[model samples]
Target: MDKEFFTPRTLGDAIGVSQSSLKRWADKGLLNVEKTAGGHRRIGMEEALRFIRESGVTVVKPDLLGLGSEDLEVQEDELSSADRLYYALHSGDETRVRSLVLNQYLDGRPLYEIFDEDIQPAMARIGLLWHDEVSGITIEHRAHDICLQVLADLRFRLPRVFTKGTAIGAAVPGDPYTLPTAMVSTALRGEGFSAVNLGPNLPIEALLDEAKKIKPVIAWLSVSHLRKAHILRTEIKELARELREQNTFLVMGGSQIHKLRLDRDPYVLIGKNIHELVSISRGLVANIPQSSESKGEFS
Candidate 1:
């Protein structure tokens, strides 16, 4: 057994693996390590024991000299990739965005999660700063464009044949912001629903046309701005009534809806969070209508 118990560098060097490889393995439940105050990863003796056991290697007395320092180096390389991505997003560095997105996709982080957690937060920060300084708009726009490109890269696994049940989502009028809608659309796709994303500036008529054409069991409207939501709600109420007659459920969300005054409109449902929307969608999927059952018209 090696004497140094909690030294990340020494142990990683001893094991001849990159620290990032060690971290990834750790993340996947293969090893244990202590993260230091300055965000550095350190390994302990118990962790080393666990790693050896998991690897099914002969438990010879561990020699620190022969393994080489590849582990620490690999860890650095992995961290470098994440760091570079963060830096590019923050600085509006477009040159490396495509390559970074491809690498991230290969690393197994879902595109929707990345857009929701990383890209959205990055844009929100930039947007807040842009209000105080005129130049911030350029940075915000660049980040947003790059994020859209990343979203476009996502390969949605559409069903080979026409499906009975599907879901539709869009941002309501005056809700030009699109990231949230995009995020929700991806989540729908992941949930096995054919999501027809109509993008921004969706009038009630256009939404109705889409709902009729797609014949989805569920329709989602996102409203990020409150004033626009107030205006859109009137239109949505009518559409909800119309959709309910056709046996379609209408769902509304976003910060705008969060602030709105909601009533007990059976035709309309409001989701407070992404999870709620997903649950509603799942229920809709499970309750799909059969061809023999004609949807009853509601008053």
Candidate 2:
């Protein structure tokens, strides 16, 4: 079978599990692994995903395992596009970046797919370059600006059905990443929700106030950094409680969300990727018969 393989360490890092835990799982046959000629263990991408889904483990890095996007036929094309975009961004080629993004949009690619399968993963790879000191801050900033502009353009062009309930999204304070929130907002919009994006670095109080005002059916928090985990945990707990009182569901995601070590709550939804976010949003929206009745009132 044609398959992708990951080293135990790489798989562990991608899934946020300890290497020892992965080895233990492998030993217990929870994970399907193969032995190389040198007796090194390697895990298949499909088996890893199966284990993750069955074990109820949240994947913090879906891109690493190629799990989010369903458009497999476009995978190679998207990867090539991402590589070109990365090179263009590094060179500060704004024209090329815009053309690449718009071309994908014009070719009938969904905004969420572009973001999830292409832009986000490319940015993540670029982030590694920054972290490793291979790329300077200026290049990173330029790339982010270009991505923001493209996402804004996409948001403007997205067709609004608004059959689903309102969604309010923000990146929690102390998490300076903007793209994750933008992706979530855009995906919600694409999924027929009236999505209000609160953008990045929003204080919990501000988000709470906005949630109260909007009374959104879904309130999404994107936590990209784990620096202020203690503070974030407190804010998230308080916000969840308030949202629960308001009868609004809270959806949380991002790379560092697993770090919070939160206990699962019935009203709080945790998504590992944009696909799951869309799925959760659809489920919640499906139950909101009121939105269907009052669609014209909001628009």
Candidate 3:
């Protein structure tokens, strides 16, 4: 994809700063810029967005940067965040929902909060709608599509992870849900881990095969749907052992995983939510021994 670039003057105007100030900041390395063939300076859209977010600058004209051209400020007078999100998902308002979520992240809210606090509650309500009415199933399916679109956009805006420790994750076999595993990868990326999401319904063999190839620092499994309890437990036990042999930690989560025998150990970790997943993963990445505090949520 071609990168979008903005001139110093355009960015300055958008943020209500002068062209000279922008140029000076660029020269001082406060802002990143590139030179055109004609020797004029240009800032990539990512850098411009970064400056706007980190500097807490009010975008007077977001159109100049190809962001939300409409009102970006979230309306708080009428509905709660989760309620508003539910309405958007049910109504299939992709643009509005995208604005709502992307703006939250740009405002410094962590991805876990967006998942645990906003998307979780909203999706819970949506799950009910999937069976309540005739059009409910269609609405639910469309909502998933819209959510996937928004997630792709959000992932693009996430700062590229360049540090060490690759992490691989996937939804358990027979689990078709996409958001939980995707959210895990995104959250790990935010914490500077090279997260690789192998996607849903991935076989245990594939996960083990990939783990052997990459030797990821952390391997994650999300259990949103359990097709066969006995087989899945056996697979998870084996997966945990495979990871432990490589000195890798296994992190697992999702609502349907409670039935599994969660064990308290150095290499096997279970979480109730995305925040715990991040906490555990980062601890392992930093080699911060949490054996004292490492206990499963269901053990």
Measured on C-alpha atoms, candidate 2 has an lDDT of: 0.77
lDDT of 3 by residue, 51-157 (tens): 77787777777667666655644456477767878888989999878878876776677888988898888888888875768788888888888888888888777
Q: Work out how many backbone clashes candidate 3 has.
A: 0
What does candidate 1 score on TM? Answer: 0.61
Q: Write the per-residue lDDT of candidate 2 for residues 1-299, one digit (tens) a residue.
A: 35568889888876788899988987897887898899998987546655665576755555565433223234445457778777777788766666566556545566667777778777776676666675566778888888888788666555545766688989888889988999899888877778889988899899899889878889999989766788788878889999999889999999889999877788889999898898888788677677444465344
**What TM-score does candidate 2 get on C-alpha atoms?**
0.69
Q: State the lDDT at 19 in candidate 2.
A: 90
TM-score, candidate 3, is 0.90
Off by over 4 Å in 1: 1-86, 95-112, 155-164, 228-230, 272-275, 289-299
TM-score of each: 0.61, 0.69, 0.90
Cα-based lDDT for every prediction? 0.63, 0.77, 0.81
Tens digit of lDDT per residue, candidate 1, span 1-299? Answer: 23335565555665566677767877997777777798877766534644553464332223452221122233446554445555676687664555455444434555555555555556667777688888778777877887676665442221112243567878877778877787677666655556778887678798898888767777888878655546665777788888988888888888778666766787687876566777777676567655632232211
Any runs in candidate 3 off by more than 4 Å, and if so which?
A: 72-76, 288-299
In angstroms, the error of model 1 at 231 is 3.7
